[model samples]
Target chain A: MAEDTNSKEYWRWTESNWRDPDIDWKAGEIISVGIDVGSVSSQAVILVDGKLYAYSNMRTGSDSPKSAENAMDWALEGTGMTQDDIHYVVGTGYGRVNVPFAKRAITEIACHARGANFMYGPTIKTVLDMGGQDCKAIRVDQKGKVVAFLMNDKCAAGTGRGMEVFANLLGIHITEVGEMSLRVEEEPPMVSSTCVVFAKSEASGLLREGWPKEKVLAAYCLAMAHRVVDLLERLGVEEDFAITGGIGKNVGVVSRIEKELGIKALKPTLDTQIAGALGGALFARALEQKGRKSK
Target chain B: MKANYGYKDGSGEFFITLDTDRCTACGDCVEACPYGVLEVVDDPVDPLSDVQVAVVTEAERKKIKYTCGPCKPVVDRPPLPCMTACPEDVIAHSW
Candidate 1:
């Protein structure tokens, strides 16, 4: 079984699931769900009374609704809970409206801000969510309300999809890019082109010229870091910085960003990719509270 | 220089185009936008041009129809606040 699974897999990052094993869902008064269907990945998060309960992250399929449902189902599995148990559902990310079960659709900007605020605490004022197809630099208030934000969906250069292409080209697993690139003794010059197509061709040329794979990866990661920092600077960065999305797990880029901005990112104990869905779940809880009070 | 906002997905395409040449980069559209969708950025589409122009924020680009849904026209309503605020008359929406 293990050999078969390994043989079938491509250069894909491992999908992940996490649950607060100690949390008793039966005792929780509120159960809310947040599903974020991104272009490259989908995440489903379950919250019990404003606390993280469970979450699942998987590659997004072509059909966003199917991806959303599958992610939620994976998260719900073995939890002894079903869709009926969820009191409020907030769908977010690229396919927010496509979430059939979501009671409301929230923008990833607001959701990421709320998630960063919760994960990094009230001091978090800046959130950089680098997702599959876009990068967002959001400034939020102490309570996780959006102050000002900017997003870059116009190009794939600085997004996860770009990184995925590079990973595939380099024949490296997506998860290994960060650590592997760090192994380079000296940082390489950044690839000039921000367009993925041009960058891919540039990488091929570098490989043919005998540049090591690690150096090429470093160059791309540096370019990505610089590009995202430009986005953050455009919106204006503040202290108490934090990053979310799949790229947040990649220290190669994150460290470079921290160095560029001169502010250490507020690290999250849990997986950073779940931040959006987690924020959505938290919003659902807030809505749940309002509903209860109004009733 | 035309910059299109929004993306093509399995469902369909939603785009909001801004002709930068007509825009004066005045803060009118930015201030008039209640949803905070428009911002003035150094024109990225035309690198040779240093002129800053109002364009849809990146996050709102791919989802403007949904993001700006609240202000969408209903039965011959007046122009949108952003469009109305634009002195240059450069904004157009593809619904």
Candidate 2:
């Protein structure tokens, strides 16, 4: 019984990886991969003949195919690439069928609308995601497919494991909970319980009435951006919009869900938790370009 | 105002709850839902109280734990045809 290592896991979160040093994956002729595995993190990506050559983002441990092969061996670590030079993999979220080196699995709502149409483009047409035990909202279309969606994974009150259990109950450091919930001094009203166990006992009863853990992380990121704007108002927020998971690196719940849906979500120069493993490596490069145009 | 609906991932809690003031848009739990997963609508939580209720079906509200897993029978379990066709008990599943 010896494993305390000075216990400081304030909801961990900080495993990373990247690659693209002007691309060269053995003169790529397709490569493609995309793991995902999500039930609280695990990405992978890698693309090549379709661009973004590497990625990682770790954490989903209790073994989902060894967290999708440790997020594809940390996105092919030194980049001398392996997994047999990958030609097509795919496997999407919620442990996408336990990704045992998937060749196809898909559905993380059509891989977060084709990974928010390749990381916020294709005019986005709304996405949202916010994963780690669920919260979807999709809509897509202009090629990213899924024209309608709205998930919630029932409870953990607005996902990302309810803001990593409210940043390990305010010991704080899940990447400083969005700038310490925007160093609050005024916003405090929400947290009326959307139910992450009753908004974490109403944020420890407002820190026992004295408040301040940045005002209970600004009333629990304004009740998780008003419960993800009531699940993106049941699929009706169209214009552009994009948000992809890992709570879109929480700018206190994406600036209060862009001030309650006045839009403005589309900003991601890559790594908004690798939009479902970059839409499962762009659906494993469109299923290896439809098996080389049906050979 | 017990709305609930479904979702509680990593395999557990598949809510359904209704009791929206004893829901009475009574489509008999949308005809004892055999996976159409109930319907009726309108009461987006008291939209100025016009009252239409029943709910759950926004595409089976995120796959109600696999569309209410075929009447949830594991042994003798027998109360679900949408909570025995809810007559004001206002449905309830929470499995």
Candidate 3:
């Protein structure tokens, strides 16, 4: 690939597949990008010498490559790092292969497992990634290799997007749904509407039925968590389970998940959302190590 | 209310499109943008998707598709239906 010599713009399209930015690039330090391109949103994580640098959560735009580029551009803006500094690039998620500039591509399942182990530790066996578009339950050995996995990619009923609707109907923030759910005394009315559109109707009906907001909200959280449970069961969840993806940030959901499965789900400080990116960054580190070993 | 994108003219993945013009400025779009990309605005064609009108100038206008992963199915086609069907309406598919 030709080096973009004129790297003097906030962002400039160097080619259809590449862009140049104004940040100075440094070598020797490993820099990589992990991109999780899902049906709902695309994410980019940038790392420098195996340290967290910057991350971007962007809509997957029209194309995975374009979305990856947009996410990469956003991460660069946050980290003040440039493409030239990146020694290795690993892309994950469904669209990892679509990343035009990625040196290698790995499955998001692997990336998530690798990322979780890196942050939490190698002992994590069961992994649950509640992504924007889907929910996945993966059982892996200590090495972060997939041993068993089940995913609800075909449906979006219980993913991060699902909670957003519950938040809107109750006139509460999405972030609050988990906390509020934890507060409910009753199990609240279970939302039977598996369909998102119909769920809104159901939630509105509950409001008309005069159910307490907390109960109704709690039901929603429990209902969504059930989906994860189902996936985990299918994958045969184990102890020291780790959760990832954007929804992992929701304490309400996480706690409910623990209750439903009768097991605690551990989340790293960065938690589920950045699992794929962290996996990408770790891969960058591994690649650099391999290069040195080879030389 | 919902718009979906087809195989991007250049890039390969199907893109989701949002008719910011048709946006009701209702919080639905705001709630729908899970990545927190869309914000309610007092003005259309401009003012309010990224930042509140007060900070509209500082707001980004580059389609900001980065905010919410749009579901633009096709120009006027029923999107993946899952996005439209999901209660969050996070996915916007023009049917």
Candidate 4:
């Protein structure tokens, strides 16, 4: 059988990295690194004396340890730094335990809360992390410790993976799905099914009924937004909420979630997806400081 | 307190809700589960509470959708073994 050469992976998102030119890592008293190995993606965050320095976001490969190493290597690409220079390492996300160099592994729930606190400031009390395989609603205290939390990982109805499947089904780029969903003429009724398999069939039926691609996207996004809202309500929303993870980049779902919750998520100055890894790095920094004090 | 173990993924919800208040740390559910998904553990929800409660094992929590799939049939689904073994009616499966 001849293999099709024209097939494209529409679900794949662009991976990238960034570093701060101003920061001198050698002068920093403590160099901490955080690696978040999620089911669909991996991110590495480097902090110098508790300040953001460099980071990388990449797709997670089948091997989680290799994915962590890839993300870390990319973050250090132009920094003139090596793994040995990192004083402490914290691993987070679903594959936290797989980070070979990490000094400690922390739950994504705690890490997301801390990361949201740092990125959005101390005022953020609620953190919604919609990751590849799971969605978590966390309530954080002033110090970013989890006060209450709820997680939904069994279903992919409102998660990033669900969005990716939709994008692939629509033969559109994953990044463009959010924008395209918003381009519809008016709001469409949400798809009834919360299960992704059923939702996909429903979407196909809508397309067969002559609904435009944008309208179908709108309906799917609305359904996702409502599903996420139900999860959030279970944990009870608080003031100054923030969103993290890949789905945070999807404006279609975010906007609908904001409308349904009647509260705006804080504008992020840093990449929202890095929240978990950043939080892990922050924890590493704290642990390093504590160790120094003990000595 | 009611603790829900297992996840709701794209396919369906496969949570086993355990009511801790009425649970007497009975090992019946653990014995009844064919997949070894249930276990008796210290009350994780309340540290002060001295009672042990039934919970889905840590390794099985993420994959309960599959571990518990055998008990769930498409038509004429029968009562789950774990739920049936719980004398206090403390276990419920949400499928």
Q: Pick the candidate with the highest TM-score.
A: 4
Order by TM-score, highest first: 4, 1, 3, 2
Better of 1 and 2 by DockQ: 2
Least well predicted 10-residue stretch by lDDT in candidate 2 chain A: A1-10
DockQ of each: 0.07, 0.09, 0.02, 0.22
Q: Which ten residues in a row have the lowest lDDT in candidate 4 chain A?
A: A1-10
CAPRI accuracy category, model 1: incorrect
CA lDDT, every model vs. true structure: 0.82, 0.78, 0.62, 0.86
Q: Per-residue lDDT of A64-140 in model 3, one digit per residue for the tens? A: 88888887777777444678777778877868789887877766766777788777888898888888776767666
TM-score of each: 0.77, 0.35, 0.64, 0.82
Share of real contacts kept by model 3?
A: 0.00
Candidate 1 lDDT tens digits, B1-95: 44555643323345676776688888798899889999998764322235787878866776676788888866676678988888888887766
Q: Which residue runs does candidate 4 get wrong by more than 4 Å?
A: A1-7, B1-5, B9-56, B63-95
Q: Which 10 successive residues of model 3 chain A have the least lDDT summed? A: A10-19
Candidate 3 displacement at residue A185 in angstroms: 2.5
Chain A TM-score per candidate? 0.95, 0.39, 0.81, 0.97
lDDT-wise, the better of 1 and 2 is: 1
lDDT of 4 by residue, A1-295 (tens): 1123334777677788999999999999999999999999899999999999999999899999999999999999989999999999999888999999998887787688788989988888988999998888888778786666667776777888899889888998888888999998889999998888999999999999999999999999999999888777756899899888888989999999999999999888988999999999998888888788999
- Model 4 docking grade: incorrect
